[model samples]
Target: MWKMKPSIALSVHFTVLLLTLSSRGSSPAGKETFSWVTLPATANLTWTPCFDTFQCTKLALPLQYSDPEAGEAQIALIMSPSNYSSNDPNYLGSVLFNPGGPGGSGVSFVQELGPYFRAVIGPQYDLIGFDPRGIGQSTPVLSLFKSPPEALEFYSTYPQNVNESISSFGRFYAQANILGKLAVDRYPTIAESVSTAAVATDMLNIAKALGQDKVNYWGVSYGSILGATFAAMFPDNVGRFIIDGVFNSHQWYQGDWSSSLLDTDDALTAVYDACVEAGPSLCALHDKSSDLIRARVNKLIDSLHVAPLAVYDDSDPSNISFGVADYTVIVLQIFQMLYTPFASGQVIFEALAALEQGNASAIWQGSVTMANDVDLATCNFNASQPFVVGFLDISAPIACGDIIADEDRVRTSDEAKSDYQRMADASSTFATTWYPLSEGRCAQWPIKAKDAFNGSFTQNTSTPILLITNTHDPVTPMVGALNMSSGFTGSIVLQQNSTGHTSLSGFSTCTAEAIHAYFANGTLPAVGTLCQTDTRIFENPSNSSGYTGVTITPLKRSAEDYSLGEAARALAGSNFLAKSAGFFGRRW
Candidate 1:
């Protein structure tokens, strides 16, 4: 409903855009000075260029903003400039970005996707990414287990065996115990400061250090939550921000573990339905019908729950072994693969076909191969079982700090177990494994963040944010975006009638273009806007390009059947969600 002033119009040219701060005078004139801090904008800061194409910088922020003068910590950042320099009329300032995993290295994100971002969003604004406190490259680098072997041991000890039945609670409980003890030992006081609020403040500080008056952000998945927090805290400092693959802050911090995961199950179901449509000639496990293919996959899951299948293990001199714990891990892998159906559809079909033909070793071997993003040796699955210690070491604390805990309500292990059963009954496909995994890690997380905000989320920012989400995202659902929109008054939503973890890429050329337009010129798509998904799950390039509204079988119950409080309780009973191999089919 609101538009940028004519003075700040895209075509308007200015000889100079001065952005400065002083402890004495009011904010400087122009659209570039932030007067929020009482001191000169440039405080303790340093920047250096590294890797030939990027600038690396560190800001010494107070360890605890509440006690700023008490202690300080270093926050690391990496910057990739636009094609146009500040001296050029084409320069559009900086758009700070966060790539989802609350613990995901922002430095790595910029270094890895700098060129792609510049191409998609336009090479006018500099792309800046900063590692939040307690995360990668930042000081107090939340290292859970120092070495690769130690990290392996932490995962190996939990849920001890790969062949253990899914019904067995011993493995999950064991996992919770180790996670809880390890988090306390590793992070201690520092973990308390890792909440989303703290990270939001870090973003503001980074913007000020970079000499930007307002904040410009692009965050995906969990990063969406961080973006929202920033907009809320620095409403007047709002720039153009996009929260893609929107995550529901309420569901994330509170509970309703089942609700958040419901869409993932649907996404998985979509993959099966697509495979069936492709037919056995094209799909390896495509039997006679789609229903039959789904039934077959469910049967495999059941069988694994009954007994772990034998698989090759290079760690064993005999070269053969089976651990029950690996079954859930492998299933999780399958879930991740399902995210990019068009890209990895055939590979998934082949993997399922191998399983149908009784080749269990090949499946685990496949997982090892796909998850090799690193040196391959880094996440060596040659051991007795496989596991990955991902961004969770930092993600857990930040997430735990944000949500209101249900621990006191549960009171005992038996109550927690009962609650888990209730969740499984509601939707076993999404809940059974994921609910337990996420809860296990969080329940054991020791500290409650003193700075985390769980109060009213309303805010009147200078400019409203643009929220986007795929119709069927695997991790953060469409419902999340819908719900999150209500909290931010005046915010607009763009529903990409597609399916995936995020709304960009080949999935929807339309969605990508819409995002590009907003960044290039601050124009929001009209209310109730829905962009058609140009690429179908298994559709080839020559096929018709448009949204197919092909409804994957909906969840049995209406979402309204459960309340947020109920969902929160469900989440409270669980701990850490299982970690994924960084990328699909690539384990580094």
Candidate 2:
């Protein structure tokens, strides 16, 4: 995973396309003052206790921004003041929240994490959670494939042979295009409606609707991109803003999803290296870290390519042979498991070991289920199929049509494929085994490289912003976060030395203390400050006992909480046939 630094220019290009959209009119400057326009309260509105002891309400905004007269989309919004006193006009403004996932649901995340936030921010700020446009409980929720089976069908049947790959790619694109059109037909203008730019405008509108002139914001993952876009468009109105798991604005639009994959591989290798240093007692591969673990895993994947392994029970109609793609899926799955030393050393090792024994069920069946559950709980979309379909439906038209231009489209599929292939080839030591296995869907999806993807944020405004990142995050990657930090003029970066998707929720006490201090008193941590948290703390499953002050429950024994276990089983079962299925199917 550790490699020499590569130029971020290409990555930046893709990010810009993902975030920056060229508006018919220039973005509203942060310094610009706008008056609030109040609308009559609607009967459909409902209220609940805020996550932190105050009243919260769900508000509806026009589904079509261009036509305010059009019907509305419901957004779950929670508000809790810094102080509980009845009279506080001088109240600190509300801070809108986003937990990421162009698809991640904010309401649920707030419910789970609100207490922690309340403890940190104290009684000085009102925290708000609202589902983004076209997401959870928000009107016109985008549901793609009906079941995980449908998605698994597509991913499992993806073609690997040159001719088959080409035809499969074509079919996948055509199907996705059709699906997007259907979603648009069902909810007209929805594609153009869900852009981050539109969402930014919506945030401002929400602030005005709540009788506030300005607002503070906290966004994670995709949420960060949303927040940054808002800051770019309305810098003057920007209050205290925090963006965690920062996404590079440039790489987003350029259609380089590969970077995220590479980041995962790099992160995994980092863990593997650490395991080697920690010695055999801590890492299964032990003295064989470099050769036995890494090499053996690669060898198993290669073996699967030659002779697919049968992983399902003969009685099961859904049983199939495992191939290369399954291998990639399992590898990706293992990438996340590395978040803990025990998971990395034990669970992942067992899974990999199973694959070496020619068993594919361990990898294929579990991954498919995890992917599906992620979609259901977070985005309320189907992940069984290529995720591109859901993303394209909600993203492409806005990202591609508005921000990126037709001229900027990558001239040919061959060109784009070649670029990706080159990156894969350069990383042949690992990429050869994993990259091809992972890129089946993106390769098949219809994407035209856009020029708008090449731009960068010129945050000329003086508004104070805070950026947080995990030093070893696999998903968003540290480099991308650093790129965003450098783009902002007065922004500060807080680095948490830990592993995981985002740094805010799970981090070192030092980092939490710094963030809490900032939220309470508007103090920014010094740039390049490092907060250390040992990720291994969670490795001892019993640690949950201390936190919850309850007995640790075995996953298998708790049927009520078996939702996670079942989902993992489903994913593993479905993906059992792909080339890399063994990687995910094996048990610890």
Candidate 3:
């Protein structure tokens, strides 16, 4: 039982704060010099001041990194200065922070939580956040879809029945094809297109523009993938890089959706078990330890598949019944909310109890539609879902296909479906559904993959990268972290025994302290060293001090059995197991 101080004791450290503009290298002896080129910032670039008192600067970079001589893209760069800037001589470098979501805006995220960084990292380093290319403040952002309600309608209407699912798949594919064709006709992938590689280059260019030779980066969720890729590409330019919610670049490129889904499922089960073990004193769903929470939860999920529950609209009084898929989406959203216990736990437990009571408004309120405001024209697709599906669907055909003749093309649709089904059967129950959902969207989208996906991490470089992962993260599971650790030779792994998506700012005092020390001193934790987190810091709604209602649940045997049973039923009669057994059997 690892016990630490309560949440309030987690104070924001504000000592030794300093901020200084970078100057040109005077002598060039053990110093680097970068010519400062201050171009006109974009007009559309917007700035919302830091909520906790900080200054923000909007910067512009080329939309396409490869062709800097081409058109420009505007990015919002927010800088939170140290309190003691005038006194300190050795000013720590600017620590760029990214809260993931190739779509998530760093400017707003850090502006809101700037004080938290100041408290944890102290006042030495200036915390800077910039919206990545194709994201907020970055020009020509990816705003393809309509409102959240519209997006939900699109997603919810997806056919769950075999015949409808297949028809829906075709419709989606047609739409994507149309969209892709339009995109290609309108703007070809020139040297300056917005790609992950391009984003890495932009980071380096941003550092150079800021008049800094090396940068300290703190990237969460999707930001982890960006950070790792940047490190892989520009190793020497990395001063201190912390990548939380590890994204396996190999698995990502290879399209290993089934594996990723399994990982997520396992993490969720762990949460469920933890909640059960915490008992009635803590968790609302409290029952006897042997009461089998996972079984009950599964039963509730199955029941929804048949009858569903009508949840009252948060905004309106109208009640709406939700299907199993809707419930699944709610579960995914709750997984993220787990990071903020107080805000999520009560909501999750209440929703669960509601499901038991034939109501589901709590779940609906916290569903993806509500939480992400997904219907917004600015954001239609969730960032992680596409990546997961794309990887698995694209990788199998490429990995197992005859590459010489079919170099660029994937396996035939039928073949790919069969392969996916087989993989799902052998892996997890949700794989069948998840695999299709993940890849199905791409079927309609017109752009063909550049090449057969390969599970290879381009790691010939000598970059000192630091990889941080939570042992029980629901999104980018621990297995993904392990896969990343195995791939990046120069990378250091910091395994925090925490739950949720990111770990750097979301873990216990010791973990957070170690992260601060590493960023501040450029030191890496010992390999295989595990940082214990304070699991007691749940999201307690009753307690005004903590987040609304988030709680941690451990994975237990009953949950595993339930999940396994669900998988077996979902992948019944598909050749899924025969093909996937090779990969999934290793888990046993």
Candidate 4:
């Protein structure tokens, strides 16, 4: 699936909070400097133990930094100190990590990957993770739909065909989103303040609060956009920054969503090739051979346009029906799975094989599994608002805050359908369905950050930045990384000749080794370095975990999670259910 974008941009007052002499170290011209100091406790904060090794704290910063009196919002932060001896003279400083999604929970990211990071980055640096404003665990969390089920309902409203005839359904769907409408109406400030630039500023504030003089960062996907913004805004503070699955900051700020999805078609083809290469022993759909499998899959999708598939749902004790919209959602899920084909390969194979067999059980079963993973507290979904709004319900504002959108580019449902046709012509795999779907939603967003960065990308930073990417990343394509690298002075681009999203781990050992080296000593990989991917698509993983000699607990797949044959069920629904499951299950 494609990343979400806000439809419109409205100008609003911005608050710029600059760190002064007392807060920052005085460095000589063109050189980065930092003076460490502890932050005294404030009246507005509460600190609590997060885990045995980590402490969690909440800080209330001005909702609008430019207007301190406007109000304040709390952001959640979790920090774990380095295991290295504090007395060691060679102890490395703190490093900030972001897993992207603009809406992805950084707290969850740290909790899951901390040990892996500590091993790679060395235990000499503090690991810090925070939920960006309006995101997970942060104050004023944005919830587009009350629950995952509601999100599924919202997605269910999408028109199966792309044409002006179906525009009314889209309009009704947008207006019917009472929760979404209420959210935007109630908190306009968040919409205006959640841009990447603002988040980058938040990063700086986090560093200052932590008494760090310089910043070391590892950001992926949209996080790369934030890192780029941080580099542009506070160039001197930059230290050994690594941006993986690089985002084209220019494209992002300019609100060109289509550019990101242009490569999805090619990536999907690669998945097909990889599946064929795997053979029937490894790939569930391999019995039909590559071209035949594709034909059957396409036929299945086409057939759904005429009549929905009824899949047996053991829980419902009846058949669950899937409409064209539901079919599209499964397609998007397959596309996402292609990102980490090794881990998700089996899932994709089974899902598609079931589709070929006219069985809807696999799709319904996946939905139930996904529903179990969702946090009910975060999702306050009700029956009235049934939509599968992506992780973007919370993320779109941040995107709007960072980018300048052309109001004209924003489209009505009919216009969006037209746009979808053009996109489909270029890339059928994703553009046809996603373009129209996004345009309709984005057209309704009516705010933008006043201080969104659109300045010259060229800047004199304190150190060279490292850029990493996979050749066939479904979301952030490699070309964007190369384009971004050209703008940053001395930035090195390390291309991983692989298929996936981020290349730092599992996807490419060469890339991870290169990153480890850069972290140890701020030396860029030789320019034009092309790292080889060790994971084979169809073969058993040569190295299940990316680490050289470490074992990671594997995710268990249930025996009941099997391919469904042509069994009819009682329920009929759209593809949004599939996408809803993906909300908790990220392709990356």
**Tens digits of lDDT, candidate 1, 471-553:** 77766778888888888878899987765566641245566667778899888889989887654455432112221221112
Q: Write the per-residue lDDT of candidate 2 for residues 369-411, one digit (tens) a residue.
A: 3333333334443233223223333333444433444454422
Q: What tens digits encode model 4's per-residue C-alpha lDDT throughout 1-588? A: 111111000000000000011111122244333211122224343445544456667676767767777666567766667766556776777788876766655665564445556555655687787777776556655555545556555544443223223464464446524434644686677677676776787788777776676789988777788889899889899988998878688877765566666566666667778877777766666744667777777776666655666543344447332322255445545654544554455555665566666665454343422332332324523233222234446555666455576554334656545645655665665554444334334444566774467566687788899998877776677888888888889999998877656664234556656776788778688988998866666664322222121112212322123111100000000111122212232211
Give Cα distance to truth, residue 109, candidate 3, Å. 1.9
Error of 1 at 180 (Å): 2.6
For lDDT, candidate 1 versus 3, the one ahead is 1
Better of 2 and 3 by lDDT: 2
- Could you give the C-alpha RMSD of every candidate to the true structure, in order shown? 14.1, 11.5, 13.6, 11.8
* Worst window of 10 by summed lDDT in candidate 3: 11-20
lDDT of 3 by residue, 109-181 (tens): 5544455566566667878877665444444444332334544444344432222233644554444354344
- Each model's TM-score? 0.77, 0.69, 0.70, 0.76
RMSD of 1: 14.1
Count of residue pairs whose backbone atoms collide, per candidate? 35, 55, 46, 23
Cα lDDT for residue 314, model 4? 41
Candidate rank order under TM-score: 1, 4, 3, 2
